[model samples]
Target: LVVFLFKQALTWIFGLLVVEKNLISYPYRLFFKKANKANFSFEYFIYPGLCALFSLYYPKNKSNLLKTLHFFISTSVIVIFEIIAVKYTKLIKYKKWTWYWSFITIWITDYVTHAFHKWFFKTKFHE
Candidate 1:
């Protein structure tokens, strides 16, 4: 839940900036059509849920190479699907954005959230 919320907060800020900058758009949002330009569903729910999964399943004891591979594969899957959505769907549109932006942002956010998760659960306390 911590990871999910962290991702959600990051997305809310960055996603709004991307939309406000005309870098990307969502033509078919389920909510927040007037209050914001970003895709609420994706930024608020979908991406955060995915981040939770990423943090939960992350291999903490793995080698550096394996950890890097995990990040690469997870980020690549989202970028590949996003490319397809851009090509065939009206869910997301790229104005000044590209697949690399999504890839980089996702990778960075996931890395940050993973680091947060580690620091968060690193020690136990009782009151």
Candidate 2:
């Protein structure tokens, strides 16, 4: 799926940039012997996969309440998982970042990506 692929790539770019900037770190990662702090599993796969599904099924031309509710629900799920991961699995370690920061980033990224996806569909790959 182009949507999934694009979202996956975008997530990796943003996630890696965050790691490189030292805003966040991943002490535990997958598909690598040494942790690189990029969160390959989550960024390259999990989160984008979730995004793909969400985008595919997200209601269109919906009421503002529905859209807001959707965003809040998705953000809450992610934040809860992140909290657990940070506390129990030690998967993520925040240096200059905070949980609220992650929340806002996720919220903004989702909306922007969704907008791009809609535009791409409308343009039929012309852009």
**Candidate 2 lDDT:** 0.82
Q: Residue-wise lDDT of candidate 1 within 25-105, one digit each (tens)?
A: 899888978999999988899899988998888887999998999899999988999999999999999999999989999
lDDT of 1 at 8: 91
Best by TM-score: 1
For model 2, which pairs clash?
A: none
Candidate 2 residue lDDT tens string, 10-119: 88788888999999888766576375668777887788888887788787889989988888888789988998887887788878988898899888888888888888
- What are the C-alpha RMSDs, in order, of all predicted structures? 2.7, 2.7
Candidate 1 residue-wise lDDT at 80: 95
Give the alpha-carbon lDDT of every model: 0.91, 0.82
TM-score of 2: 0.87
Superposition error at 72 for model 1 (Å): 0.5
TM-score of each: 0.94, 0.87
